[model samples]
Target: MRVALGVSYNGQSYDGWQSQPSGRTVQDQLEKALGKFADQRISTLCAGRTDAGVHGLMQVVHFDTSAERAPYAWVRGTNSFLPRDIAVQWAHVVPDEFHCRASALSRRYAYSLLESPVRPSVDAGRVGWVFQPLDLAAMQAAATRLLGEHDFTSFRASACQALSPVKNLLRIEISRRGAYWRFEFEANAFLHHMIRNIMGCLIVIGQGKQAPEWIDEVLAARSRDAAAPTFSPDGLYFLGPRYDARWGLPDRTPAYDWLP
Candidate 1:
């Protein structure tokens, strides 16, 4: 049987999502827990991979296992062996044809920022920080140029392994509440550091360092050198993949409520 699970993790302490030989990644920890619970080796494939210092709200994964257990049993059993920072939110018995990555219609991500003069203390390693007051209108104008499909080479990391730079950006919603700013993005797929790279440009533009038209120019250039540096991964979150309703999977977890 194949099982699909919704996972959430604080990526601050781990290397990243992929299992590493160092055995210090979210995947490594989760797989270890699963193995312990089932008393058999287990492996998983995820819908998306988040960078270090990044967080995940509803990262989906699937694994093939001969261990037969109730859905809730899998959830409670696996989580029992996991650490405090990583958790298996929910689980379901999925069809053999269901793949967490390929079955997704779209992926969503959120970036949280603190726009205050003081550096974060309690929320350290949880949000990106900008001391300058942002010009919301200018940033919104700049974001309009990125609404549709385009070759996002300018904003992609050089180490990105994605075959192509072209990606359909379904939406970009920026909003603010007090000293906190939230940027939500939906896309067919994302290149490595795509959102962080774009956030770098947007931050500069919002700070009045550049004009809104610069985003268009950068997109047209399709050169990595034309864009701003990649921003911090602290604030980035893999909001999760959107699957067809027929799958009957939950879109979000409790972690979503805690984020801005």
Candidate 2:
């Protein structure tokens, strides 16, 4: 039978979401934990691969199990085996056709910032600690121009292997809540490091380092070099993927294990 698991992780200690030959990864760690509970290897397909040092709040993975286990035990038992930095938030048994990544209709990501003059040493692992105040209004204005369907070559990685650069940006908004500035984005799919790259360019504009109108120019350029440097990985999170309810899950829920 197939089962889907929701996972949350601190990405600092690992290479990325995939299993790597040279370094530790979330998949490697999760498989290690699975050793105590099952005989066969527990291989999971993620909603998407988060780059090195990128955290997650709602990454979904699915694996097969020969022996029946309680749905909730996948959470409690896996949590007991896994390290504190990585956790299993929930699980649901599903049909074999239910995929963690391929079936996703849309994905959401969030970029977080600490906007203040004083450095924040405490949440250094949780957010992009910026000691400069950003112009939230300017950032929001700039983000709007990039909305809608377009070829996002500028923000994609140089080595990005995606066959197509075209992606639909359902919504992109910049909102401020107290000392934190958030860039919320929902899209049909994302190119490699797309959200982080967008945030880096927007940061420059927010800090008066670049003209807000330059965003349109960068998008038009459609070249990786035309965009700003990709932002730090810590501030970004693969929030979750949206799927149809017929896949044996609810349409929406307030609970998220992978919020970054």
Candidate 3:
């Protein structure tokens, strides 16, 4: 059986989402947990990869099983094996052809303003809280300019393995809630560190270090260093993927709200 799972985590302690040979990683830990809990040597595929220090509020993944498993078996079993930092939020059986990555139509992500030099009592690991204040209005204006399909060469990591720099940015929204600033985006796909780099540029303007309109110059530069700086990984989150009906998971509830 093919299964889809919802997971969330505090990425501060691991290297990243993908398994790595050198340091600890979310994938490696999950695989180990699967071995212990499911007792089936199960492997999983995620909707997207998040870097070390990045969090996930609603990440998705798929795995295969040799025999039928109950919904709670995946949730309860996986949770039992996983460390406290990672949690299996939910699970459902899915079609064999359904993929956590390839079958996704779009993905959404969010980042935060993590710093405050004046009053620094905030949680240390969630968002990229900067010391200085940010101009939320200006940041939102700049974010709106990033919508649409474009070559994000300027913001992608130099080591990014993606074949193309062009991606369809479906939405880029900015909102402020008291001292917290939110940067949310939805796109067909993203290059490695693309969102972080973009956040870096936005923060520069928010702090009045650069003009909001500088987004155009950064995108046109098509170089990693051209943007402000990669924002701290703490504020980033791999939200989830959206799928079409044809690629539906077998046990997906009508409540899954897979559609927008």
After aligning candidate 3 to the native by TM-score, how far in Å is the CA of 231 from where it should be? 1.0
lDDT agreement of model 3 with the native:
0.81
What lDDT, from 0 to 1, does candidate 1 have? Answer: 0.95
Q: Candidates' TM-scores?
A: 0.99, 0.93, 0.91
Q: List clashing residue pairs in candidate 2.
A: 56-258, 57-258, 57-259, 58-258
- In order, what lDDT does every prediction score? 0.95, 0.83, 0.81
lDDT of 2 by residue, 48-161 (tens): 889888887778888888958898887888788888999887789999999888899999888778887886677776788677878877888888888999999999998788
Name the regions of candidate 1 deviating beyond 4 angstroms.
none
What is the Å distance of residue 187 in model 1 from its true position?
Answer: 0.2
Local error of candidate 2 at 168, Å? Answer: 0.8
Give the worst 10-residue stretch by lDDT in candidate 1.
251-260
Q: Assess candidate 2 and give its lDDT.
A: 0.83
- 1 against 2, candidate with superior TM-score: 1
RMSD of each: 0.7, 2.0, 3.7
lDDT of 2 at 226: 95
